[model samples]
Target: MTADKKSITALIIDDDQMVADMLGQILQDAGLNTIITFDGKSAIKLYLDKKPDIIFSDFLMPEINGVMVLKAIKALNAKIPIVLFTGYYNQLMDELKGEIVKPDRILRKPFIQVEKIHDLIREFFPGYEIDA
Candidate 1:
């Protein structure tokens, strides 16, 4: 489906409340609907219920990590685009090697720009154009 025709729903998962709120705001500003979860455990339940078009999850969480979250979501919908965000990008990438469930993208922490978020949406949902 074309991006214009596709419904953009984003699931933002991060243990840090501030980070989740920031990402949610960015997605909202980009004209996409979003659901924010502070933990991976709840995120899985939310994912099942909401079935968002894309997901942004922090690699490190209290109990279930981002990789685990991705696996759980993949079990339900393998095609969903999941981006793993972490401060320790290199460490997480190294840990994810040889893993069956992999993230579609990796985002570094302290995400600075809304444009990067838009780019991610545009990447997954082709034809998506930001409204001025």
Candidate 2:
């Protein structure tokens, strides 16, 4: 069954407050609720409590990092979609090559393409339709 667009929640984890907030804003604008955390550790807690439909995490974080978040969340709910964001996309890609568990998607930094974010929600969630 397709979930209601308004009921969808996105978890955003990034050590950089600006980047996290910016991504949260973009998702919020698309009619999804957002829960943002500045650390991967706390993000784990939020993920458990909120049970968000999707996750957007930065590859480099102070304590826990995005890969850790990805593994932890995947363990909890493998069906949930997790998107890893990194400026060093190439390096992260190489790092993930041998890993058994990896993020469902990887987004390049700067978050320049707003439509991409909207498209992700639409792709994962058939009922979600956000204007470009």
Candidate 3:
């Protein structure tokens, strides 16, 4: 079944408030509802409660990390798309090598290209219209 465009939601987990807000705005511009959390623990809780259509999460955090978040969410909903964000992309990739549970995508920090966020929304939720 196709997701109702208006009902589409995105869960954003980032310790950096600025990055979280930036990502939230990008998703909102793509016509998505967004839930932002500063930690992976709260993110998992939000995931169960909201069941967002997609997820964008930071790779490093206290208590739980992106891999933990990815594995936890994937266990419940494998079909949901999840992207990981990190400043240490190469290291994270090396660490994830051979891992069964992995993010659908990994993005590097200093998000200069706003289009990447729009592209992700388009890739995962093609029905949603992105604002130019």
Measured by TM-score, the strongest candidate is 2
Residue-level lDDT of model 2, residues 49-129, one tens digit each, is 989999999999887889988999999999999999999998898879889999988999987899988888888998767
Name the runs in model 2 displaced over 4 angstroms. none
- The TM-scores, one per candidate, come to 0.93, 0.95, 0.93
TM-score of 1: 0.93
Tens digit of per-residue lDDT, candidate 1, span 51-82: 89999999999889999999999998999999
TM-score of 3: 0.93
For model 3, what is the error of residue 17's alpha carbon versus the real structure, in angstroms, after optimal superposition? Answer: 0.8
Best by lDDT: 2
- The order by descending TM-score is 2, 3, 1
Off by over 4 Å in 3: 1-3
* Per-model lDDT: 0.88, 0.90, 0.88
Error of 2 at 12 (Å): 0.4
